[model samples]
Target: MSTGFKCRNCGSNEIEEDNARGDRVCMNCGSVLEDSLIVSEVQFEEMGHGASAIGQFVSAESSGGATNYGYGKFQVGSGTESREVTIKKAKKDITLLCQQLQLTQHYADTALNFFKMALHRHLTRGRKSTHIYAACVYMTCRTEGTSHLLIDISDVQQICSYELGRTYLKLSHALCINIPSVDAFDYLICLLASQYLLERI
Candidate 1:
């Protein structure tokens, strides 16, 4: 996440966060930089497509799935879960994943938007949320020119890389999002830099 906050004691950039303790500490000097980090619970599920009439009304002729309720219970990824529950789980998963991948907030938000689009278009039906969320994050990394590879997401999600790639391509085509070709050099640079950091540590 490349936070700009540095330790006052040792002026180190290597700060570790313990979410359980809500503490940001310097790895070099073992000094606490911030004792309180506000973890936000305001999630994407709260924003219910306000004022978008299109979000409310869908033609029964076009809608082939089971009927849903205003309370937000719907079919998603093979599970009949409420909108709040599904989106909340996705929100938490994406947040933790973005942090693990060191993706910026822009990329994270873009990924979440893509997931929302998928939900709108019913692309998530009969699919696994884990794969869908992985695909969203991978698509964000691809479209935003990030150096993260699809295999990275697969490793974290414990899914097959090819399956994840297929999900990503399906979501891209369904959302009509144009993903750019990856630059091998950027990935190489990222890998080398990661190796350097490991050696430094």
Candidate 2:
């Protein structure tokens, strides 16, 4: 049985097996070729009960194992909480801005969607969230054929008018969003409203 197998170390076939210890030894280099061979079967027999049983066991070698979930339970829970907090805050700010500007529900919803998109694109980086939010509202008004100048939005949001304009331009170019030209009537109406409010003050 040992003659067919070659010693891996010395390439010798002079192998000897010790049945008691279950080890096959290479006689040429005194190296162990194989050890702890399972050569016997375990039998269970009942003498007077007239019952005999035989069992065979098998095991498989595994290359590796994997887990289903990558993140821990606490990590996933905390991440969900953080996301919810951010969304809730954004919604509150957007709603307040819309109310202050007296925007209709339709326009408010459109602006909210635009703000969410800008958040998703990370366009608000290194700038106040309020600025991005105001820009979205301004863009939404323009898109909906309503006139709201950058200065008007900046006044409402308390952001610098020039900074808000630059932010809006950056967002429009980066997102490839094309807003329609403001209608002449929209500007006229806004101007008249501002003059009317000024006269009242």
Candidate 1: C-alpha RMSD after superposition: 16.8
Looking at candidate 1, the ten consecutive residues that score lowest on lDDT are 50-59
> Candidate 2 on 3-98: residue-level lDDT in tens?
577889768786766443345766544356676655466666686856543322322442221112235642211122343355457767877888
Please give the range of 10 consecutive residues that has the lowest summed lDDT in model 2: 61-70
> What would the per-residue lDDT of candidate 1 be over residues 1-201, giving only the tens digit for each residue?
226678786587866664423457664433457766645443223345542221222235733222334554542222223653665677788877888898877776667767766775689998898889988898788877877887788788888765666677678777777678656753453455455546756
lDDT of 1 at 20: 29
Off by over 4 Å in 2: 1-76, 182-201
TM-score of each: 0.51, 0.51
lDDT of all predictions: 0.65, 0.62
